[model samples]
Target: MLVSTRLGAARQIADEAALALRPEHPEYFSAIPPPDPKALRSDVGGDLSQLFLLLALVCLFIGAVGIANTTLVSVMERTAEIELGRALGARGLHITVQFLAESTLLGLLGGLVGTSLGMVGVVVVCAVQKWTPVLATRAEFVAASSPCRNW
Candidate 1:
């Protein structure tokens, strides 16, 4: 059963509904006041945030594993070159630093490529939808600042 009331009369209508139904049909009288929808919205938002955080952690783990595997493979394939460098008086520290720099560069490049692809995908989707891409900077700032209580 659905009942529509004028604006700002939800509570009154809800109470009326409860009063009317609770007497004869006690089993069917479930009164949900106006605040319930807001509460449910917050609850769903919290659940979605937790889900996104979990997904982000999983993706970070996968990316770390991929970087480590790539670094290991590069080192393995360059074993001969590394031995040659050592024979020519390259210290262990030098080799370690070289590998570290290579891995750092690889990670940075991966991030840049991923960012570019994501931007392109967003643009493509917007174009396909014939929607103008609007940047709501104020809303973004408010949302970003809300968690810090600085908004």
Candidate 2:
């Protein structure tokens, strides 16, 4: 609801600006009619942001399942090693902490390597396409400030 309201407000402001400029610049406004409010509303209703959000959620679930499976296998394979550690006075908490630390490090390293490879791939594709690789500074800044710790 709030998003719709804000979009409506923005549309109104743009319409007013167009009207103000119409007399001075007749060529630009001659063929452009004001956008229908209902049409605009309907168009903005199905935002791609929500789609990307859903995709992100699905990816997160898949990643979690994969990690869980990997951890389970690791635990199973290292049962004897863990038992030895326990026999040597390693507490259950200590084992849990060690596993958590290893997983965290794996995630971090994977992210870094993946990001580097992706960037190189993008650059190569752009070069092959004969397009200048332009980076949006504002977008980069927003991404840097986001809670998501992108590599």
**Best of the candidates, TM-score:** 1
| Model 1 score (lDDT) | 0.73
Worst 10 residues of 2 by lDDT: 141-150
Candidate 2 ranges with C-alpha deviation above 4 Å: 1-46, 135-151
Q: Give the per-residue lDDT digits (tens) of candidate 1, residues 7-116.
A: 77888888778667677766577766666577888999898888877876787689889999999999999999999999999999999999999999998788667755
List TM-score per model, in order. 0.70, 0.56
Measured with C-alpha atoms, the lDDT of residue 101 in candidate 1 is 96
Please list the residue runs of candidate 1 whose C-alpha ends up more than 4 Å from where it truly belongs after superposition. Answer: 1-8, 21-28, 33-46, 134-151
Q: Residue pairs in steric clash, candidate 1?
A: none
Q: How much is the lDDT of residue 53 in candidate 2? A: 73
lDDT of 2: 0.63
Name the lDDT value of residue 37 in candidate 2: 79
